[model samples]
Target: MSKFTSILARTFLQCRPMTNVSTKNMNMLSLMKSNSNPINRLAILSISDFNKRHKSSATSSLADKELATFLQDEIENETKSMETKATSPTFEGFNTELKDAKVILTKKSGKESFKVIFNVNNSLDNNSEEEYSEQKNVSDNKSNEDVELGSPISKPTYTIELEKNGQIMAFYCSFAEEGSYEDGNQSSPDSAGYSDLYRIDEISIYQNEYTDDSYSVTCDLLDEQMYEKLFNMLEDRGLGNEFASKLAEFSTAYEHKLYVNLLSKIKNFISS
Candidate 1:
């Protein structure tokens, strides 16, 4: 799985198809991994069954409206839109508009399944500028700025498996390599220079269970090396205390603090 974290989604397909899922139980072994460069769209292949439940709200309760307003204001005017479909579409015959998010159906085995498209806002440029500015300022005190890392390709779409009861199953999160891209003259990172943003190297989610990208395994679930790496990343952000507090809530077996902290610098949308 460590090898998976460092490669592109294309690499995920290069190897021969496995008899069983490559990752313990992450069913999404076949994937385009969903690209973000051109535009965000999630298409599931090989699913044998699916059902869609669509609902759109033009009017809402005060609380719902408030939450919607809060999310909009929180994203620096980025609305983060999503749309849901009420029925299944044919194989390669989906007819919905290209949207930030949409609901669709697919089939697997003899049963149907539902998939929700979660559109992750692209923050590569935002993160790059912030990191570069901070590092450049620090270097100014010494002598000159020397930032090496270039912006990363952000995962724009997340196709999450949903249970009949509407519980989340698993989602595919593909990331791009650091320095794999540059400003104004971008090129594909198809060959090498790819990496995982959430640090999981494979398609499998931690424990082969229901957890969003915001959710992560408990300390015991991670090996010493991965644990230490995540801990260090948290330390750099002065959120070691928050991280410790999250782990302290022993009953909350799945902790999402580190991911939420890194992904949502302005808000904890996952928990919300």
Candidate 2:
């Protein structure tokens, strides 16, 4: 038998115990069982094709060993520096429930009940950090020490709802990165208010029952005073500047933990 055919047979035997082998590999192995010179028939195949066809066995290759080592180091490094937020344990009077990537916080005050929802998926991104850095230079030109806000945390979208009696009012809100003001004028009506804060996008009111037909009014249509009043209402409910900052921090920590968990899962899968 040729050296190439010998290698192919060894690979076939090595992966035969793996129940997850691809159909293509199984077909190739079956062809080898019937063919006299499987190597000669597959001679014209490029190196890339061979690598792709045998990717399952390649998990034990040297490249994967290096990758596994790198992931181990990365996971350790991230875990060492990880600092969870105070909200991770509990956020004030609101009870927390985590459903996959989404976080739902609920609380009741007097006769009104509130629900706040946000998702951690794609909430923390390096691209936004770069954009915020550029904007900071253009707007204030302050040193990192002067700013002290650290990397732009999460600019996650949040859905806040209030229920009173039999009516529900929902506010769709989003976090704005600090130092993201255009024209360096935060008070400008065109701006989304001062940076590093959450702003309301739209408001919808409906009966206790909600459906797809519910109508929402965009906050842009509201006058300046009306907008401020709406924002202040949220502030009174503990969703103000301090809460926004803490939310960003908590989101960053939560997202990073999720990422590390994913990395560990992938590492185990490849090693197996």
Judged by TM-score, which candidate is best? 2
- In terms of lDDT, the poorest run of 10 residues in model 2 is 181-190
Model 1 ranges with Cα > 4 A deviation: 1-109, 112-116, 123-154, 157-159, 162-168, 172-176, 179-272
Q: lDDT (0-100) at residue 47 of candidate 1?
A: 25
Q: Estimate each model's TM-score.
A: 0.22, 0.66
lDDT of 1 by residue, 49-140 (tens): 22221122323344565665665464432222111211212233222232323223333322424343433344233555577677656666
**lDDT, model 2:** 0.75
lDDT of all predictions = 0.37, 0.75
Question: What is the alpha-carbon RMSD of candidate 2 to the true structure?
Answer: 13.4
Q: Per-residue CA lDDT of candidate 2, range 1-272, in tens? A: 99999999999997777578699998877767666475755663556587776885665587789989999998996676464333364578888888878989899999999998999997875666786687667547655455533344666888888999999999888765444544322223445533436677789999986689999988777886787788779889887777777777778777777877888998998789
lDDT of 1: 0.37
